[model samples]
Target: MIDQYSFLRPWLFCLDPEKAHNLTLSNLDRAERWGLLQRFITKPIADPHTLCGIQFPNPVGLAAGLDKDGKHIDSLAALGFGFLEIGTVTPRAQPGNPKPRMFRLPEAEGIINRMGFNNDGVDACVARVRKSKFWQSGGVLGLNIGKNASTPIEQASQDYVFAMAAVYEIASYITVNISSPNTQHLRSLQSEEMLRSLLHDLSEERKKLSDRYGVHKPLFLKIAPDLDQEDIHLIAELLVEFGIDAVIATNTTISRETVKGMEYGEEAGGLSGAPVRAASSQVIKTLKARLGNALPIIGVGGILSGADAREKVMAGASLIQLYSGLIYRGPELVNECANALRR
Candidate 1:
């Protein structure tokens, strides 16, 4: 059962990370279909917060990457996340990097993954989102988009623009993810010139989509945790200049100082979980200082407890999200965070 994930943890941990993830979602799907998930999934207490013109029932969200293809929306929503985000879905489907791309560092309570935007593509993901009960449940849903791995850095906007067009009508908001380190040259999009062009193109496209759908869906930019003063300042400037809707700070860290010698510590992928907590909060702090009220931030990265979630909000995050924490703590972290924020 979902809440009884502790009982299944040992068995799930025995399999490969990706395989375990697939099994978990598959079982969740089966449970939801049988109407048995509600027994295991707790109802998150209500604590409304609105950002990007959308009101969330609560602030704690299930971050993107867990349901890359939007396949388990209704089932995953049973966990009581205030909102749910799906995909890093691209214009085309592609098998990501080779096997063993995801590694669990249990000792460090972190995970390293280079799963390069491997989704069922924008079309399938959109169709699935349109079909999910969560989509029509009036719950906040964000569709995170990214360029395909094979897409060149020079023409990355094409993939983002295409994916945005496909999901625009249905998503409560769209997240432009240019921060994942797994894709080659993907983070290069965060550079000033490229970042400007990417935001500019998406902004322009949003206008047309708004007119076509008669409603505008907000566009949030997801950034990486490894940033400096210059990087943060320029990104804040570009976001404001382009009128981006919101920002999801600190995707995952390429920095490994926190887990250097631990098993699977040297793996070549972005690191997340307890290891990235401080780095993510600091990014939120910096962005809050620069953006002020001009933009709102959704803080994510390494939130494993209520205090960690509270620290993010105290640091100026408009809201927070979880990925690795959910993997390590199970569904209870969702309610723990919701209650913490309510207090």
Candidate 2:
């Protein structure tokens, strides 16, 4: 039951946020191994939707950043996610920003993390994916890629191209992540000039990879929730122009207007959860208006309930994803959202 998480939240909150995060995943792995997960977790509803040539079992998905290394794929899939996305992974392993980089704002149902792209690198993540039963069975997995922290912003395209080539054959679709706020200057890739160049390079690389593999893998761009009307319009135009498969609208927000005056409210990082629900929806609604059906939108931000999930669809998202919501609502939230989005 979803209330199981409510019971456990108090104890988890007592520990440091990152430590609690790791402990939860570690225990989940054990539970899945012992066959306890399938017994306790509800099965996801069957509501298949096809986009970018991949058939999703349901519209609700586990967003990237949770399983940064593909370490808990089989375990997380047991919780009823229709699809699972992993990473913000880079070309090389990284230690990330520093300790105490993640903060929780229980009063506001939000989390702020500047963990950078802390991951074990793309090669390791690829190996883990290859070993996964889910991937072996052709699960719809999206590999979110990014550049190394040490790489200059000007040469970031090289890093994206390198990572994309590594996961080309294994991924259901590749998400070019250029919106994470944690990495210094990472968000600069969103600028029209820089974005155009990056997209050009990625498109060229995709052509070569597709010809080599004899199958076309879709590319989806992940954008921030912190853009203006002008930026949104420009991005929508670019997506259509480049023939991008889909767009993941509204990553974590740097704006703290909603959670101000609360504990850890002023922490320096992108804020997610309920505080971002409205902003993310607004972005989805605007993108839908501009892009229409020329491109699909994968809405992911502060979806904590079935109603929130439906709202994303109402704003024209073909699919939805969850991250912080899992921390607050637990595994049952997956089934709840899937059922709500079922037509």
Candidate 3:
């Protein structure tokens, strides 16, 4: 079966990355409407795991970028992801960078994108999730929120707080995304001083929302894979100090080392896929060592196979997520990787 599906890859790889992504997502949406996706693909692995006060049927999750606006949650959920993360949603909707902003590095099983955090905004995203049958199922759903592109760095925390308040009602977990490389100066938010202040404010907001809604959802911070050991240690210290519920060990990286000679390697955005495995694993290991069971870590980046998934778990990731790997390996990758974890 996997061999038969291999034929689809060459054709999918031929199109531009962004267009190929839209086409794939649209096809999945259609498959869900016809009730055919499940017949063809097995359901996600069902070994339940708990983290940060929520239960996930499996450690495998679909990362944030793939379903940015919460538009295709039902369809994506049907593809058998244990958890779905939607959006790098901002306070206000904004059109991101101009076309040809996404590139594929097939040679490295990687993708480079500078989409600039394009999305339909937090309110619309929350509304879509609320309306979706997927959310109603009580499946783990994470909202990855970011600042609007035009927002100044000084006021970025305001945007995070605003989006958090807007989606707190429906989100199973909320991820504070300060690592997207496409946005101008967004990574700067990861600095110790800036990150401490941001998490401090967001932490207070989470408590208030928990009290008001009578539910305490985990708040996780998503950092970049581009950080060095020093950077990871500093951020981990603050994560502990701020009482954050979890750490999403990585977002896409700005490093071009993996796809050095590829045509798209020089594209100006974050890179994700096979090449990121080593760097991302290092981040997870460092965090686990520093925080030592105090904070859970969601390992993501370059998870292309079962071995890669197992490596992350060994490195101390309580859960794992994939975006670029799914694009390259297809849905079977999910079950294959999860089954490996069970062993």
Top lDDT prediction, candidate number: 2
**Candidate 1: tens digits of C-alpha lDDT, residues 53-116:** 8889999998999999989999888888889999899999998989889999999999999998
lDDT of 3 at 55: 84
C-alpha displacement of 97 in model 2, angstroms? 0.5
Pull out the clashing pairs in model 2: none
- Best by the TM-score measure: 2
| TM-scores, all models, native as reference | 0.98, 0.99, 0.98
- Deviation in angstroms for 314 in model 2? 0.5
Candidate 2 per-residue C-alpha lDDT over 1-343 given as tens digits, one digit per residue, 9 for 90 to 100:
6778889989999999999999999999999999999899998768899999999998889899999999999999888888999998899999999889999999888999999999999999999999998899888999999999999999999999999999999999999999999999999999999999999999999999999999999999999999998999999999988889999987999999999799999999889999999999999999999998998999999999999999999998999999999999888899889988884
lDDT of 3 by residue, 45-163 (tens): 58999888788988899999999999999998987788999998999999999888998888888888899989988989999999899899788899999999899999999999999
Once fitted onto the true fold, the runs of candidate 3 whose alpha carbons sit more than 4 angstroms away are 1-4
Clash total of candidate 1:
0
Candidate 1 lDDT score relative to the true structure: 0.91
Q: Which lDDT value does model 1 have at 233?
A: 92
